[model samples]
Target: MKRFHVHVVVPKLDESVRFYSSMFGANPTVLKDDYAKWMLEDPRVNFAISARGGEAGVNHLGFQVDSEEELTALREQVVAGSVEIQDQPGAQCCYAASDKYWTQDPAGVPWETYHTLGDIPLFGADSHEKTVAGASSACCAPAVSIPAVVQRKVGCG
Candidate 1:
């Protein structure tokens, strides 16, 4: 099984948590001082929000896979589609260790495909401080410049 993932940066963590909780009709499965996550079974989504002081909007979207095989399958699909991808074999982010690949959509929205390994104490194992938008240094995929030809074919430009 794969769970759709959405991470958002918020200005007010507590208020956003409260609003999301009310809207989802449930409390967060994991709540930290600055972060909250709701693992919803009904929708099969891993929705998270944090007040790290960055922009108050969507940070990234992802698919959370249950196994390495599923992750590999997704990577194959991305490759077949000729999309630019960055592979993080063992990444520690959002308090979980995962093997992930990162890419951007035509509109430049970042997307992640990962298989969670386990949980960790810190948001990320990297040394970089949180960004003004409240996202960790490893929160999103590093930007990759798309080739003009590919961009044109995809109507990106």
Candidate 2:
């Protein structure tokens, strides 16, 4: 089953964890000093929060697939919609190694489509890559400029 993934950039991890825990009515499935995740069965969502650099709101949203095949299909879907996608074959982000495709919504919010390969000990890769938003993205979010034509078709331009 594919899970809906929502990553929120939080100002305070401990405070957000407490609020979400109460809202979900369960403790986080995984909790770290600066990150927390709730793998909720009822909602079938992978909800995560981190004290990462960015606005304190939705960092990105993604679909968490169970296999690479599913991830490929998602990439194709984005392409078919005329949106350009940036591929990350083995990206270590959000404490997981994943094969992912990154793209932006018409409104320019980052969206990820990925299959988790395994877990890692860190939030993201060590060396920072220049991101679309400048500096580095919180969770290996790819930095790509969508073509003007593509953006126009999607009403972003």
Q: Can you write out model 1's per-residue Cα lDDT over 75-115, one digit (the tens) per residue?
A: 99888777777677777778888888777787877788899
Worst 10 residues of 1 by lDDT: 143-152
Query: In each prediction, how many residue pairs overlap at the backbone (N, C-alpha, C within less than 3 A)?
Result: 6, 0
| lDDT of candidate 2 over 1-157, digit per residue (tens) | 7999998989999899999999999999999988899999999999999996777888788899999888878788778877877666777887888888777876877787889898999888635644544545446566455332174423555
Model-by-model lDDT, in order?
0.79, 0.80
Candidates' TM-scores? 0.85, 0.86
**Backbone clashes counted, model 1:** 6
**Regions of candidate 2 where Cα sits further than 4 Å from its true position:** 129-138, 143-157
